[model samples]
Target: MSVNPFPEMDSVSTAEPEPSPFDPIPRGEPVPDWEEARIVWKSTWNIHVYGFATIFLLFTIFSTYRFLKLYSFKAARMSNGYQLKLGLYIAICLFSLLRSLVLFTDAYNSWNIFPPILAKVLWSLAYPCLIGAFTVLLAVLLATTNACHRGKSLASSYKHGIGMGCCLLGYTALVVTADWAVMYSQRSIFLLVLCQVIFIAWGTIVMIGYASIACKITRDLSRTPLNVDRGLLRSFARLLCVCSVIGGICILMKFYAAVSTFSSRSESEDSPQPWRWLAFETTQRAIECSMCLLLILITGRADRKREILVVPKIMCNGITIISGLESGTVLKDIRLKDKQIIH
Candidate 1:
């Protein structure tokens, strides 16, 4: 009677059910071939990579052109300040190129076209390059300021610049080593947080330096000679302020990312969403390139022949005398009157 009531249930097989399409492969089955498996699992091409590559390439080209044009100018080669500025521009170009390569490597790694190790290596290299470029920029700013305000040549600041550059390089090396060690050996979240915190502090200091430089320029503009374009100086001061603010925002974003990662318990949560991270990265790059371009323009205009008058005081005195003579032959008349009075 019980069998009759549950005939359909009894008829159902007790053997393991067939695997559904969404189900994982059964343990008894042979593993799929790598090529076949990859074909099935491969992700779509990363559009962010293409966008980043294009932006960076364009920036690199423009920067290179500007650098070449500036370098070709006789004045640029002759002036220590101009040379320092050229160095900064070249460093920016290199940074952009390296960033593009790093992005490409990362995209290739994600597509399985290149090994993940290549991406890691490129990232490490790119990070150092970034630090170096930043250091060069800072040194240029300091040297330029000293040259303008204190009448000190870039050559005089060489010792200080070298010391600062070495310190930054050493710090970057330590951070890179710690990052790799933590990634490979310990994988400690605390260590990661500490590294991020240290980086944040360093970045903050750099931004503060930028802000201070901006303020100094603004304060000194009133005392700057009329020969220097006041408008250009003001624009440069404003640009520096903008850079400092933007840099601060970037630091805050990095801090937020670190906090979010620390709070997240799962790997998925810890990892930034692709589109969001891509947008952040793109925005950051765009701002950086734009700032560099603006810097080039401002400096170029400032370096124009008429913007800064380097005429000697002797030339100025001669010119003043010539102008006085042109107004009237007063000196000759005075000499004739003196001769008549003596007779």
Candidate 2:
């Protein structure tokens, strides 16, 4: 018998390296076990938030329908800028509802079941919409207080709406490039959340200031039945402030999540209270929904005020009947005239 001098050669064997359990982490693509994330949400989140979110979604849809009816009912009362402001408000509500729906779907799937590009696009669209909503709010307050009113002023709300559309486009471009080019890295996401938190806080302050002015102005209009009281304004401001704080907390959690995710600490920390994205989203939607419901209530009350006076509902037939034919007049003149028929 002879002992082999080099035993290292004898140990060679046939085996393949383990396949990737998931795609690159930067892509934010979920691994196979990502479905287990549902358990994390189930254990950690407040059940009530979920309940509120459901109610909110349904209520918002109903409110939107009612608002459209209200628009038709008193079409002549609202100026073009005013109509545009209301339209923007609806857009905000729609976006908020969309976010809630996406969150529910994410929880149900236990991961970002949304494709990377789609996920990025949706998120990108969200920020601008949210910011635009607030911008219109500010614009309305400014308009009501002074000549800042668009469709009625040099600085038009229509321009703001158009600007927001542009913003959405810009953000979409940025996010698509970032997600694909940069891998949606932890540092980048963390920084993004941090900036969002700061902006949220600042925005809350701005909202409070503007809302205070709006409330004061509304109170002076004793003759107008639709004048919103200071109480409602205060409530809205307070809610905005609260949401801002919550936003900060959520950003922190997101930062930690990004950190843990990238460092692979999630595997080692077997804690039951796993911070979850779905839970954060639920909380966010709960707060936002509450705010939106309040706005809907206010708008609904304002619109129906005439009903209390027993005004009959205006019915618009599908016909655009015109009186004397003015050849030289442009489309604007007709639109203005059409808008003059009040309920």
Candidate 3:
């Protein structure tokens, strides 16, 4: 038997192309309402769970850095900026780890007919971390200000700082209150929107404060190189701004999509919005990781002697050289007048 000259190739070319895995499937029959709900719920939960994973990875890197620093630095317990910063970072890492475990369990157990009570408990535990992060952010902003440690009489500055800090705290509280209200409304979309607004506003205010402080430092120490890595500082600032804006946008988009779905009672089983949440979560975590990395660069090899008490340029017109000194290393008794310096 002879083979046909034109085999199945001709027919295949005329026939409609078979749908590939990558090809989009056209909507056909409507899915059951209950099945659709389950699908949406699972998809949303998956996104939320993936957010935890991203957070965990960021904190893991930070924790690893902290562990190494604690090991390498002999004076880790000293009451210095390094120690304080390390403590804050470590605490954040621990909090993230705990949250990760809770969210992971929530994802796994969400398959139950009814939501698990344990998941609610786990979420409540995360509330503290949220508050703590905001608090630390405010502190960081204050630290960047000249009022933190400045002038012949910093009493005034201290009072001002306290007042400003309280204001920030109040703002954070309002945000938290809004979050609870939205969440209670059973509107996940609104909750996400509220969270995004709070975080973005916080980040923006902090960044502006930081830039102002950095500028003051530069202007005062114009003669000295300042030794600060300008590139690094700029990178950190840009990262903060970009992450805040991007995160806000992503969250808002997801919130709107969810609202639309709920309002229209759309029966579309497959939801792509969850993927958007995953992306936002990933970006936020990446920013956290970058922050840890920047901190490591600043404090990893801190020189004790070099840790000069930053004074206003006017207070010490003379260049102060800071060098590493072993513990118990004492400087010769040189009579120097006490002068106040702003950060």
Winner by lDDT: 1
Of 1 and 2, the candidate ranking higher by TM-score: 1
RMSD of 3: 15.2
Compared with the true structure, all predictions reach lDDT values of 0.54, 0.47, 0.44
lDDT of 2 by residue, 288-342 (tens): 6654554454334334432221111111331212211112233245446546643
lDDT of 1 by residue, 1-343 (tens): 3447766775586556775544322111012243443454344224556676777777678778877877777744554355555655676677678767766655424444544334444544554444445545555565445423334444355543566557656766665555454444434445556657766887787778778767766766665544445675577778778877776776687677566555554433434444455456566666656555555554454345423312111121222111010112342454456567679
Score candidate 3 by lDDT.
Answer: 0.44
Clashing pairs in 2: none
| lDDT for each residue of candidate 3 in 277-319, tens digit (9 for 90 to 100) | 4455455545544444444443333333433322222233344
* Position 21, candidate 2: lDDT: 41
Consecutive 10-residue window with the lowest summed lDDT within model 1: 318-327
For model 1, what is the C-alpha lDDT against the true structure?
0.54
TM-score of 2: 0.56
Q: Ranking by TM-score, best first?
A: 1, 2, 3
Candidate 1 has a TM-score of 0.63
